[model samples]
Target: MSIHHRIATAAAAAVAAVALVLVGAGPAVAGSPHFIKNATTASLDGTSLVVDFKEAGLESGSVETITVTAHLDATFSCVNGGNNVPSDPKKTTISDEFSNSDDFTAGKNGNVVGSLPLSPPAAASVLDCPKGQKATLISGTWSDISIEDETSGAFLAIPGSFSF
Candidate 1:
């Protein structure tokens, strides 16, 4: 072959090799989730907590939202006596019902867990709170995390703490 012809063939081969390597290096894509569930409740610490979920039937790129409720008011008292997590929030409107928030684009369809940070004002509301006491809303900051597929009613909540 002539000198010009040889150089042209080498350039084309190099480009093909680089493209193959890049495609193999990324994470695998998944299908949209079929089930999205999580849980939340009050923690004893009065300062922090833990939250997690299982992303089943999850797709590769769509965003998923989990809703964790942090209930408030005087009707709650973790140390003395408090109700379990609230069963009533009028109706899950993605706003008044969910007290805390987080976002995760599913990776391989599994649990996406994390620590939850919270303030008193972000505490669960029980219709009222006395001077020094607050509702049993996930204390130490806690598990008021909710995961919602909006179009679907698939979701969950749990309880935990962050007291340190």
Candidate 2:
């Protein structure tokens, strides 16, 4: 082949290699959910609600907080507390605190799964009922809420509806 043709072929190969590397090293897209396989699931067992969160985009071994808001249809009056109505009477918010595992690394493109048991004093005050009371969730809607990366001080809000 001519020297000119050989030089052109080498240049084309170099350009293609660089392009592939850029595509592979792309950062995680902003505003995209890091959670996979259903971000959250809440199961009501008797008077307690166990919420499991499966998410990503958080640093390993970091302390993270999970908040859940229950949306109700009307004002709920509980026997064990005061008026027991949310200022935003339509929704009641609850939070669970926990720490990520020492090896729980969900880099920019990974996932971390965690679970919290909402029981007794902590969960009771949220449900607005005394401990051991059969707290009925009532006809309402609940959400996964938010997840924060304590290590990086980054917060990601989990909307009620999301897929993949």
Candidate 1 global TM-score: 0.37
Say which candidate scores most in lDDT. 2
Query: lDDT per model, in order?
Result: 0.44, 0.46
Off by over 4 Å in 1: 1-45, 74-98, 110-118, 122-153, 157-164
Best candidate, TM-score: 2
Q: Give one digit per residue, the lDDT tens place, for model 1 in 19-64.
A: 8999888865554444433332334434433344455655555466
lDDT of 2 by residue, 48-122 (tens): 445566666554444444443332231222332343433433334433332232224454444556665433233
Lowest lDDT block of 10, candidate 1: 89-98
Question: Over all chains combined, what TM-score does candidate 2 have?
Answer: 0.38
TM-scores for all candidates: the values are 0.37, 0.38
